[model samples]
Structure formats: structure tokens, C-alpha cells
Target: MAASSDAACPADPPAIDLRGLTKRFGRTTAVEDLSLTVGRGEVFGFLGPNGAGKSTTIRILLGLVRASAGSATLFGDDVRDVRRAHRHVAYVPADVSLWPSLTGAEILRLLERTGSAVDHEYRGLLVERFALDLDRAAKTYSTGNRQKVALIAAFATRAPLLILDEPTSGLDPLMDREFRRCVIEARDRGQTVFLSSHLLDEVEALCDRVAILRSGRLVEVARIAELRRLRRTEVEVSFTGQPPDLTRTPGVLETQDLGDSRLRFTLSGAAAPALRTLASSEIQTIEVRVPTLEEIFLEYYGGQDR
Candidate 1:
């Protein structure tokens, strides 16, 4: 008799569903047998390097491109029946396509008229939150300013679903924080956000779960907390005199010496033992730092610093 294997259960009323979704251009297979689900009101992050079919998958989901094989359902409606579900979903692309001649106010009015009723109060709040100068013409704004305009327009609406592709491309650090706040606010209001971005940190900060793709293949789907469990912490200890030998610590991966009476090493697991070890010694100071999303991104992509 063969041994039984654990089978993953299907999601209950998925917010977004793709089963065996495949796309092809002549001989090139853009996406192959990709199946995934996102729960309602969850901020799901799609992560991948350049040309990893991220855009292709998004285009198919938006009904902008036809899939060669398989099916997609957004909010329980068939992909072919997109118009029915599209009203609930709003998409912000990497390259915003606002009319160059249109003023910020004009573009906002147009998008609002196309979709459901505009939330004037929310729009005003977003303009102020993102620090967007609505008086400027679309063509005259800088990259960051243009990004602000797009963000304000997309987030101002009370849409149930938001599909943002590289949403914060040109924003400064402060604006990025504002963007995060907006996402959180939307999630709190029961809105589901599907974000595709190269900025892993933003994903780590904002997404409840993240799906990593490598070479058009889905490599990993993990929760933010679970992914953080896989993170390594760097411990730096400065000694009043000579450094104590930390060669025997169980989770210690490596250790190095700093010229200024300091030693640094990495711990693959908990920092409790490392802290205990340092406390026992005549340490002047100690610093512990966790791995950033960028570092984790490099590791998952088969880059160095593993």
C-alpha cells in the first residue's frame, strides 16, 4: 500500500483565483500552470525579478490580454466577464498613462466618472496626504510628482480591490510611508490589495503574504511573519579588552573582528543565547540587526550573501 500524502485544501470563496493559467507568445511560454488564491481584504504581494512574467500575469487578470490556457476568476466572475467584476477592482500600472494635456483635477474627474461615484472627501484627503499639487499639468510634473498624482487618484476611490504594479516607482521615502498608510487604511476598510513590486521592503512592510517568482515560476508563497522567521540577525559585540571566543555557539553562522575592539557575527536563529554570551563578557556595547528584505531577496534569487 502506498503512503498517503498531505493534500492542500482549496480556498473558500477566493478573492482572486487563477487555475492552470498559461500564456504564450509564439514559442515562448510566459506563464505555465500557475495556480494561486488571495483571500478577500488581504494585501497580497507578487514578487519577481525583471521579465519574470509578473506583468503578463497582471495583464491577464485585468482582462487586457487573453490567456492561452486555463481560467481566472476575480470576485467569482469569469475572466471573460471582466466588465461585471471590473467595477470592484481598480488597477494602477507601473507607467501611469494620464493625458498630458489634462490637469490633475481633470484626470481625477474622468477616472471618477468612468468608475463608481467619486468620494470627494477621500479625494481631498488623499491629495493632501500625498502632498500632490493639483494645479500643475500632468506633463509638467516630475516622476515623483506624477507618482503622487497616480497614487492619490487610485486610492481616493472606495474600490473593493486594488491591483497596483510597481506603485511607488518614483516616490521619495516620506511619500512611500504615506503610500503604506493608505494601503493600511484601505485594508482596514475591507479592501483587498494585490501589489506587484521589485521593492521587497515595501512588500515586507505592507503585504500579509508574498508570492515570489523566479524565471516565470512561482518559487515561494509565505506569510510576512513566516518569512521573518527565516531571517538571520547580525550581532556585533564590542569588548572592553580582547574579544571572547564565540566559536561554539550553536546558531552562530560566522564571526569576524572589527578593528575598534569589536566583533561581528550572524545568528541564524534566536538571539537569546548570543545576548547571554555577550552579557557574561566585559562587553562595552552590543548591536543586533536583522536581515533586510533586500538581503532576503538576493538570497532567494541565488545571489551571494547566503
Candidate 2:
């Protein structure tokens, strides 16, 4: 029997979805009313300072810690449905610990056999590229080497979703770049990567969108460009003549005079009026730079200690 054209196809679900997620331990609340969605093939950045409940949120998604409220779903399956959701997720924790007696190769083999859907060919390349010594025991590896093993295994799994929590904390500069390359490659392969890292520059480089958390609540979720638009720009102008009067100028927040030629000021909102003031003088040089992700992160986490 043939199905009719009117038959409806199932709609694809997002890679990760949360609705009014919350968690509390006894008297303290860890996460509160947080909700977010990470679409398939998206590299999403989760950022927050210490004690911001980032770990609690992740644990809820992993089903390691139960949420006090709301729900978490992966690919349309509730996170509580561990069999289905877990199968699609490969996770790398902030600190990776393995069986001391197992060699790197042995550990990888076990991970594959556990049904993470490892691509053997890709695993071999990762082992070589990450410079992992398969013959060495896990107990003998340095912090960086241990991270390499975890990263290699997780990336090789080829799971539809990769959840990395500060995965590059132990890597050196060179290896850091390598990790970034791997993340880019993962996104290109249409794999979803949920990266929780304190590395603002790394997030800015790799993430299509970022969600910032403060205390137990979500503060902002936006693309990098959109986030930048909400920030103030720093402007510096070197003049050949007396600095033009910027007094009572719209959009100018703070102004500082550097020597007799250079002036620095912070600009918010529109810049056209400020630029006109700078142009009135014989400008020798000018620098207009947007705030970095670190600056934006500070804007959210600064002042109040939690």
C-alpha cells in the first residue's frame, strides 16, 4: 500500500531545547527560569563566571542532576529519555579522568564499543594530529595529554551533538588553535557543538550565537554581531590642531586628552555626531574599535559578586 501525498512528515527538532529550566539544592537555587534553544549544526557558546550555574544547567541536560523545574529535550526527546538523547550526545567535561591502568588506545576502543558511533578513520587522524601516545597509560599522561585523549575521543564519535565544557583549559597556544580548527570542522560537518568556556576570544571566534548567564538567570542570547551592537565603542583621535570641543556632545560618554595631540573617549549610541566633532579638527589619525566579548561579559558579571 502506498502512502498518500497528504501524509505529513515529522518535523525535525532542535539539537537542544530547554523551557523554563530551574534547579535548586536544599536552600539554594542554582538555575532559575532559564530557557534556550540550540539548533542542529549550530555552534552555541554558553558563558558565565564562577557560581553562575552553568554546570548545573549542563548536568540537567546530561541527566546527572535532576532539574527542580521545567524540561530539557534533545532532538525532540526529553533529556530524561537518556537512551535516545544520550545516544546523540558526546560530552567532554572540564576535567577528564580515565581508568589509570587503561592505555589511551584501550580507552578509545572502549568508548567506541560503548556505541558512541566512532569513526575509526577519523579517530586515527585525531590521535596523530593531537599527538596522543596510545601506548602510554592514562595515569602517566600530563593534564594537556589527558585533555587530548578526551578531545580525540569526543570528536571522533561523530555524534550529532558535542557538549564541551572548558575542553581546552589545559591545551597550550598551538593546541588551542588546533582545538578551534576542530570546532570549525565540526560545524562545517553539520554537527552541533555546545561549548561552555571561559575563553571569550574562543567563543567569539567559533560560536554562531552565545548565551550569557548571570547568577542563576539568562542575561542575553544573541549572535556576535548583534551583541556588539549593544556595546559602546572606543574612539581615539590624534589631531594636528587643538582638539575640537566635544562638550555636551550626544553619544559621548567619557573623554580623555592624551598629550597635546591624542584624545580618547568612549562612545555609545550614534557615532555620526561624535565623528563630526572629531572631523572639525585636523585629525592626524583615528581608531574606532568595538568592545570585545570579554568587555561584554564584564558588563554582565561586573560589580556584583555572587
lDDT of each: 0.84, 0.91
- Which candidate leads the pack in lDDT? 2
Q: After superposition, how far is residue 214 of candidate 1 from its true place, in Å?
A: 1.0
Instruction: For candidate 2, write residues 223-271 as lDDT tens digits.
Output: 9988987898999988886786888899898898888689899888888
Score every model by TM-score: 0.83, 0.91
In terms of TM-score, how similar is model 2 to the real structure? 0.91
lDDT of 1 by residue, 1-306 (tens): 755677676655777998988899999988887888998999999988887889999999888899999998888887777788687787888887678998888888888887755579998998988888887889998888887777787788888889999999988899999999999998998989999998888898899999887766777788876676697778888888667677887688779987888898988767677677777789987787877777777778776522
Query: Clashing residue pairs, candidate 1?
Result: none
